[model samples]
Target: MNLTLAIAIIAVAAGVIAAAMRRVPIGQVHSLYRRGQPLRLLEPGTHWVVPGLDRIGHRIDLGGQVLRFEQPQADSHELRGTVYWQVLEPERAEATIDEAPQLIRCGALAALGESPLAAGDRRDLGSRMKQALNGALRERGLMITRVELEIA
Candidate 1:
């Protein structure tokens, strides 16, 4: 009985170790940074990760992702916007940004930053934001599918 228990424990441990070492999947992309440089891209299929040496990062969808930015109103203006983007190069996508969401946020903000609109101009601001996002994403090898404004 004791021998059987020991064998079971060993089996479980081995399984866990194997699972840990296996590559992450391709649908999910992991950003690898080494010495503050985008080092490698992990795909969805599976990847061997150095248990301690290489840091395993969050899984970002290589496929299209949708982002919504709340329209900020300072006085009497209404603001609301959305952006849809997809990764053109999985490797570049992973390597380019520290965090996928941060990249998205930054893109949205950068797009917004380039605009000359004031706080109250929701429509103009949204249009400028879309243009800006597309321009910025082009640099990162990402494609912006669409930008839409919500009525609410």
Candidate 2:
């Protein structure tokens, strides 16, 4: 009975240790939470957390992302484009990482809607949209690197 109890305790300890150790991969950041509250951002490496008391809230990719959107204009035409962006600050972006794509899409549609559309102005429009998106996304720790609009 004593030997069985010892083995059981050792197995439980191993399980707890395994649960406490977290390994974050390269080019990714994890948001640590304690009892449903935000704690901190965990960078790429091995980390330890209190078993059952702490959890990984969000796993944010520190890599580039692409958002493709299509918006219809009053002229019955459509504005379609791909936006290239990435997370510059995971700490500030943790809250909006999941909504980044939707935010970019909405911002792009609004910017395009405000501009006068013309075949000769597509290039200028792309640049303007990039600027507008970056302006809105900067505070969220995201940046628009490039905006590619399809000429149609």
Candidate 3:
């Protein structure tokens, strides 16, 4: 009876674990990071992750992505642009999502804020900001295909 009870408990635990883990499918990517280290990219299919330790930071489809930003100066001049991008390394994005872009934004804003262009330096500011974003994206293996500038 004791042996049978032990076997039943083990079976129950296995069942619970099986229920907790899942698979990721293809054509889509899931980012996984644990303890500041990035794991392999989870392709489309079933992906089993640790119940509470590993987390998905972001999911990117195989397709491209777009992001836009605009900054208005006190003098009514503004800088605006759009970025076309795609992921190259899933692991890097998963591990550094929270920090890389934050640092990049601070750097870009500081550069623009200190510039002495009388007309608010919209063109120059936009160029610098795009460069900063490209550098930040490189670390995560994302390619910035284009930066289109426009007045707003």
Q: In candidate 1, what residue range of length 10 has the lowest lDDT sum?
A: 70-79
TM-score of each model, paired residue for residue: 0.61, 0.92, 0.57
Provide the RMSD of all predictions against the true structure, rounded to 1 decimal.
5.0, 1.6, 5.2
Return the lDDT, model 3, position 47.
Answer: 69
Worst 10 residues of 3 by lDDT: 114-123
Instruction: Please list the residue runs of candidate 3 whose C-alpha ends up more than 4 Å from where it truly belongs after superposition.
Output: 1-21, 33-39, 49-62, 100-104, 107-132
> What TM value does model 2 have?
0.92
lDDT against true structure, model 2: 0.90
Error of 3 at 67 (Å): 2.5
Best by TM-score: 2
How much lDDT does each candidate structure score?
Answer: 0.65, 0.90, 0.65
What lDDT does candidate 2 reach at residue 2?
100
Q: Model 2, range 10-119, lDDT digits (tens) per residue?
A: 99999999999999999999999998999999999999999989999999988898889887766777778999999999989999988998999999988887444788
lDDT per residue, candidate 1, 1-152, as tens digits? 99999999999988767756746665677776555566676766666654445665546676778877764444434446677888787665655545555666776665554333454565665677667776776767677777766434
Runs of candidate 2 exceeding 4 Å displacement: 114-116
